[model samples]
Target: MKPASKSPSLKCLFLVAALAVWPLPAALAQPQGESFSGYLQTVAAKARREGISETAITRTLSGLTPNQRVIELDSAQPGSQGGPPPMAPYIARHVGPSIVSRGRGRHAELSGVIRKVEARYGVPGPVLLAIWGHETNYGSYVGDFDLARSLATLAWEGRRRDLFEGELIALLKMVDRGVPSYKLKGSWAGAFGYPQFLPSVYLRLAVDGDGDGHADIFSSPSDTLASIANYFRDAGWRQGQPWGVRASVPSGFNVGAYSTRLTAPRCERVHERHSRWKSVSEWRALGVAPMAPIGGDVLASLFQPDGPGTPAYLLTGNYRVILQYNCSNYYALSVGLLADEIAR
Candidate 1:
C-alpha cells in the first residue's frame, strides 16, 4: 500500500518514460555483485525454503531481469525522510470538490455493498471509497508493472534489500498457490491491486469480499471495497466513530502547547506535528470545537496543518487507522476529509 501514493508521489508512467530515454542497457548498468540473476537465485532459494515448490520458483523467476526504473524511483523519492510539509495544498488538491464529487457518485453506485463491508469490518463505506479513489482513482488505473518482476528487481537492487526481498518471496508463494504473475500488476515497488496493497499486506489481510472464491482486488469493485474494509479492520479502525472533523480554534490559543512530545517509533516526524490526545471536553475548554458534536469527552488529537491562521482539525484514533494506510499526514487527512464529503 505504500507504493501508490494518494497524491502519486512518484508517477509510474513518468518513471517509465524517464527510463526509456536512458542510453545504457539496464542490466549492464548494474553495480558489482547485484546482478539480476544472482538476486533471483537468492530469492528462489529463500522461497523454496519457505515451502514454495522448486517448480513454482523456477517458473516465476526464470528470465526475470532488473527494472532500472524501480531503483531510480526508489532512490530519488521526494520528501521521503523529510519534515512534515504544509498540508494546505495537499488537502486542497486531494480532498477538493472534484474528488469529493466523484466519490459521492461512486458511493451511490455501491451503497449496498459498502454497507455490508462496513457492518462486518466496522469501517465506513465512505472511508473505503476514499481509499479506493485515492489509491487508483476507484480502480481507473491499478498500475501495470508486474509484481513478481518489480519485487524481484527492487530486492536485487539491494538498497532496501530486506524489505523487497521479503516481498519477492511472498510473491513466489502467491504464484505457487496459483495466483498468475500476469494478474499481479502495480507500482514499481510492488504495491498492487485496487488498494495498492503490497504483497506482504495482501497475503496477510486480503479477503474474499465478494464471496466469489477469490479476493480479486485488481478489477472487482466489491472485492476491492471489501479488501479495503478488511485492511481498516486489521489496522484497528474504530467503528461508528468519525475519522476527524474541521474545527474552530479560539484565537490566542497556544496551539503548540498541545503538540506531541514523544517520538513515534515510525513516521516520527509525521507524528511530531500532531498534538497530544485531549478529550473533546479539554478542547472545548480551550475553545476548540469540531464541526460535529459526538460528545465532549471523546479522545482526540489536534492538527493545525496550515498552522493557527487557518482552520484546524480534531482527529480521532480512527484517523490514525487511515494514517496506517499511507502514514502521510497529507494522505490520511485527505482521505478522512474526503470521506466526510462523500458521506455528506
Candidate 2:
C-alpha cells in the first residue's frame, strides 16, 4: 500500500489561505514598516479592478503621501479607557442657546425650501435643521482636510482599513464623475461638505434641492437640507410622529425590570441603557406618563439616563432612526430637544 499522502486536505488548505489574509483585531498593533507608496499601488490596483477611471486614479493618487495629522487624530479618539462623560454636560454644550437660536433662524429663513423638502421626504423641517446645526454648526466650519489624503492615511494606518479603503475608492469614483479636486475637503475622518457626509453617503443620498441638476452639498444650503431629509427618510423617520417626549416616572417604579436584554450589533453600549419597548398606554398604566401627547398604542422605550428624580423620556422608533445617524443617546436626545425648541 502507498504511504499516506502528505498534502493537506482541501478544507485545511482553504482555512490556511483564509488565515493568511484575515485581518488583525483593531486592538492589536498592525505590522510596521510597510511602504506607503507600495500600499497606494495596491489601492490603485483595487480602483482599477472596481472600474475606476485610470485618469481619475492618476490625477488623485499621484504624489499623494500619508497624512501624519490624520493618524494622530485617529489615535486620540475616545475608547474604553474611562467611563463616558455625563449626558447633561454634553447636551448643555451641544444644544446650548447659540445652537438653538441659530437653528430657529435657519428654520424660518429656509421655511419655503424646508416645506418643500418635508412634503417630499416626510421628514420635519426642524429635525433637518437640528441635524444640520449639530453636524457642522450650520456650515460655519466643515473642516479643511484634503479628503483623499485623510482617507488614504487612515486606511494605511490599518485600524479601520476596510472602511477607509472603501471610502478612498468611492472618492476616486467621485473624481471620475467630475467633482473638482478642491471641493474634496472635509473632516480629518473623510466626511465632507455642509452635511458632513462621507464620500459613499454623498454618492448614495446627496440630491440637488435647488434644481441645479448638480448636488452641491458643499456650498448649497438647500441641497444640504434636502440631503439630510433624504438620509432621515432612508433611516425610517416616521412622518407625523414625534421623535420622543419627556416623561414623569413614578418614584417607586423599578426601571431596571424593564431593561433591554437584546444586545445591538453596533453601539451595544449606547443601546444597553434603554428599557424594553412598551406601548404608551402600558407605560401610562405603569405610572410613566408622557408630558406631551403620544398615541396611546404607539410602541416606545423608556430612557432614564440620570436615575431617579432626573429627567426621563419615552422614545419612539424615530429616536432609533436618529441613533442610526450618530449612535449616541446624548446626540439623539439633543437633536429631538433642539427640534422641539426650533419648532416652538
Candidate 3:
C-alpha cells in the first residue's frame, strides 16, 4: 500500500548517522574566537532559560577571570606537609588560645541568640561557636577571593564541571537576588561568607535571623549563627545531645585492633583517627566512663586522636555531623572540646 513505505525507524537511524558523521559548526564545536562579549551573550541566553536575569548575568560575569590559584588550591591535599606533623602542632596552629578566647567573647555577645539556636537545633552554643571560630575566626578572616569569578572559572575549565557549573548558576541567582558582587568574595576553594559556606550550602541553609531581608553572614552575627544552626539541623543534629564526651579506655584494651580500618565515603582521614564505633552501653561495659556527665541517651564511638594513651573521647552522632562540615578529626574534636571549655 502506497508504494511500500520506507520504514520510519530506518529513516530516523539514517538521519542520526548522517548527523554523527557531519562536522559541527565552528561556533558550536568549541569556545573558539568568541569575544568575551559574545561568550556573555551565549551564557546570558542560557541563564535566561534557567530564569536568571540579564542584569544578574552581566553583574556576575563581567570582568571575570579564571582563578589559577583556586584550581591549584583545590588540587592540594590537607596533610601534604612532607612528614605528618603531630596532632599537637596542627592543633596549636589552628585551635590556639586566640580562637578559644574569641569564641568565648562571641559566645558572650550572642548568648541570647545562641540559647535560641540551641533550643531550636539541639546543637550547643559552644559547639556552634567553635565552628564559627574555626571556619573564619568568628568572621575576622572570611576569605577575599571573588566567589562569582572563581565559580565561573571553575565551571568553564570543566574538570569538575557538574559541581562547579551548578555552583556558578547559584552564584548568578545570588547576584540576581540582590547580593552585591563585592560581598561575593570568599575562600579559594569556593566557600564564602562568615561561616565559610559553599554557594550551594548558602542557598540551602542561610537564614535571615535578624529579620533582615538579606542573609548576610559576613556582617551580621545573628545571620551567621542562624545559618550555622540551620546547617547542623539539616545535617541531622539531634537536639539535647552532646557531640562527644571525654572517656578513659580500659587498661590492656587493644587500641590497634579496634582502630578504624575502613575508609569513610567522605571525611576518610577524619574517621581514621577514631577507633571503631560501639554502643555507649558496650563501651561502659568495657570500663569506659563518661569523663563529663552528659544528659540523654546517645550512641557514641571511641576516639583517641593521638593514639590510645592520649586524651580519649566518646563521640556521638552529632560529632559526625560536625565532620561533614570539615572532615578533620582534629578540627571536629578541637571544636567540640573548645566549645565545652568556653561553656564552662
On lDDT, the candidate that comes out on top is: 2
Whole-model alpha-carbon lDDT for candidate 1 = 0.79
Candidate 1 lDDT over residue span 1-344, tens digit each: 11211221234234323333334355455554655665566675566567776555656666566677777887788755655578888888888788888899999998889888888988889899999989988888888887877887777677777998898887776776667777978998899888999878888888887888887888888988888888888888877789878889888778899888788888887788889999988988879988786567688889888776797989888988888889988899888888888988
Which residue pairs collide in model 1, if any? 1-198, 281-296
Off-target runs (Cα >4 Å) in candidate 1 are 1-32, 79-83
Rank the candidate models, highest TM-score first: 2, 1, 3
lDDT rank, highest first?
2, 1, 3
Residue range with the least summed lDDT across 10 consecutive positions in model 2: 1-10
Task: Give one digit per residue, the lDDT tens place, for model 2 in 105-190.
Answer: 99889999999999999999999899898898999999999999899889988889999999999998888777899899999999
Candidates in order, TM-scores: namely 0.89, 0.90, 0.81
- Give the winner by TM-score: 1 or 3: 1
Let me know the TM-score candidate 2 reaches against the reference structure: 0.90
Native-structure RMSD, model 2: 10.2
The pairs that clash in candidate 3 are 122-239
Question: Alpha carbon lDDT of residue 256, candidate 1?
Answer: 93
Write down the RMSD of candidate 1 (Cα, Å).
8.2
- Report lDDT (CA) for all predictions: 0.79, 0.86, 0.73
